[model samples]
Target: MRVGVLTGGGDCPGLNAVIRAVTKSLIGQGQCEVMGIEDGFQGLMEASPRVRELTWDQVSGILHRGGTILGTSNSANPLRDDATKALVSRNAKALGLDVLVVIGGDGTMSLAHGLADVGLHCVGVPKTIDNDIAHCERSFGFDTAVATVTDALHRIESTANSHHRVMIVETMGRHAGWIALEAGLAGGADIIVLPEIDYDIAAIALRCRERELRQRYTIICIGEGAKESGASLTVRERVEGSPDPVRLGGVAHVLRERLQPHLKSEVRATVLGHLQRGGDPTPFDRVLATRFGHRAAQLVLAREWGRMVTLQHGEIGSVALGDVANAQRTVPLDHELITTALDIGISLGR
Candidate 1:
């Protein structure tokens, strides 16, 4: 079989592990030819992509690496234009690829589903630090992102205590609050804010006052998408033609500004931005990515096209690509984590 693989959307820590696993697994079969597709679906639109043959030697030693060898792009969507879609089809046929493995989050998975409709054998491997992909309990990079944020919070907590200040740590979570929630819980944050729940600024201010009375510094973990009751804060205007136009940010600063007047302590906000997306994958992510990649190769070998590998209830499984296309798996309001946070008196800004 002639197999092609690509990674798309925002680069994450465990991407290289997936690429390595796919390449090594397919090559181990000895009857398959693997081609690395460059820059996501954009590579498919190229008249001649920078496709390269994959071998054991080339994929070795990449398990600990961050980012992807095949590259990625967020704005490359074949469905936006008929000509581009045709070009993708032509390129795939020209390369004689029997199967294509797409490793990405929601946007990229949606693209893979579209490609499958056009008769290209496509399989998806879920990849997201946000852990927001539908049908998957947890994405590979979520653990690493949470760990990174937790470590950052620990450092911030020390400084907050020393200066008797209110430190607001911003984490990445556009539509979901898994990162902020998990890291906040694990990092021992006094307050946790999420996009899923609108925050009561006045209530948060009151909490800070109470903490100040106890002579304890406050540490708040806020998701980038966290919002006020009826207001939204953004760091910048959305690009007109960008795929991800809702660039949520500045919520931490907004919170800091609003809460400063109500608190006696110094208030500051720190945005972790892309730091959560960088660095080496955690051990859990490495193993999960490897499992997802190996499962993808096995699916292709079995000709089970239009499926995406997922992890649920401590088991690796597969789901139809159509089931998760353009779907988001958000943190449920009744989740145990939320209950735990509330039980411990952490303000969710609700």
Candidate 2:
């Protein structure tokens, strides 16, 4: 059997690990051939698709690297245009690819599901720093991102203490607060804010004021998507024609400006933007990516087309692509972590 592999959506750590594992596992079997697809679905949309053979030698020594050896594009969606879809179909048939190991997040999976409907076999390996893919308890790249955010918070805390200031650190979480919530708890944040829960500026100001008398320093971890109660999300900008267009950002600054009037201490905001997305995969993420890759290979070998590899309740498994497509696993308001944060006296800005 011949297989194709591509990484789509935003680039993140552990992506190279997945590429290496998928290529090496299939090649080691000695019965399968693997090809690396360039620039995601955009490659296939080309009149002459960009592709190359993935020999065992090529995939070596990439496990420790960040990002994918196979290139990616977030804006390329063959499903949107019939002409592009036809071109992709023709290209796939011409290349004689039996299946594609698509590694990406929710938008990528949605594209994979649509491609499957047009007669291209696909197997998905969830990849996102947000850890918001439906049916998967955790996805690769999240651990590394969380570690980055936590480290940033640790570094920010020292300065915050020295200045006796209110430092607000913003993390990337377009729709979910997993990164902010987890990293805040790990880094001993005084207040943790999430997109899942509404936040009141007055409540946050009150908390900061209380800290001023005792702690004299306040550390807040806020998700990018977080906003004031009855307010719309803070959008950085919208990309026309992109699958996920709305870019959330600047909430930390918004929060800072709102709290500055009520708090005596100086308030500052730090946006940990793409810093969380680029880095070597953490040990946990490397292992998880390898596991997901192997599972994807198993599904492909078993002819389980249109399925996505998933990690549920500590076990690796597979779920239909349709189930994950267009769906997100947002953090629940009543989640155990939220309860833990509340019990520990961490203000959620509610």
Candidate 3:
């Protein structure tokens, strides 16, 4: 069987590891041929699609790399129109691919499901730094992001302490607060705000004022999707031709602006934009991505088309692509982590 592989949606740290594992595992079999689909599903829509054969040598030395060698485009969605879908199907058939191994987040999985609807077989591997994919307890790239955010917070805390000021750090999380919540606790943040919980600026200011009585400085970690009480999410901008276009950002700056009036110390805002996305994958992500990739290849060999590899409760498994397509997993309000933070005297901006 011939298989095509592509990385889609926002590029993450473990993408190269997954690509490397998939190519090596399949090519080693000798019975299966692996092909690389360039620029994601957009490649399959082209009249002369961008592609290449994946040999063992081509995938060598990429396990510790940061991004996909095959390239990716988040803005291009091949399932946007009927003509585009037909073109994609025709191109995939012309390429002689029996199945596609799609590596991506929710948007890319949705595209894979659409391609399956058009009679093209696909297997999915979840890839997202946000760790918001449904049915999967953990996704690759999230560990690296959390590490980056935590490191940044540690650095920011020193500066805030030196200046005796309030510092707000914003992290990437459009709908879920896993990055902000986990990194905040790990970095020793005094306060944390998430999209799941509405934040009261006055309450945050009260905490900052109380801290000024003792520590004289406060560190706040907030998700990009977090909002003030009775207010909508802060949007950076909107992309015209993408599946999920509402860009969430600037909540830390919003928090700084609202909190400055109530606190005596100067307030500052820092946005860890894309710093969480770039850089090499952590050791945990490397192993997890490899496991997910090998599992996906197993599914392909077992003829488990229309399924996505998942990691749930420490087990590697598979779920239907239809079950995960366009689905999102957000942080629960009663999560143990939330309870831990509260019990540790961390303010949640409630």
Per lDDT, what order, best first?
2, 3, 1
Per model, how many backbone clashes are there?
Answer: 0, 0, 0
- Write candidate 2's Cα lDDT for 1-350 as tens digits: 99999999999899988988888888775368999999888889888999999888898899999988888898888887788788899999999999999999999999999997678999999999999999999999999999999999999999999999999999997999999999999999999999999899989899999999998999999999998999889999988778888888999999988889998999999999999999899999999999998888888888999999999989999999999999999999889999999999999997
TM-score to native of every candidate shown: 0.97, 0.98, 0.99
Candidate 1 residue pairs in backbone clash: none
Off by over 4 Å in 3: none
lDDT: worst 10-residue window of model 3: 23-32
Which stretches of model 1 miss by more than 4 angstroms?
A: 233-237
Which residue pairs show collisions in model 3?
none
Instruction: List residue ranges in candidate 2 displaced over 4 A.
Output: none
lDDT of 1 by residue, 24-99 (tens): 8888864688999998888887777668887888999999998887888877786677787788888898999998
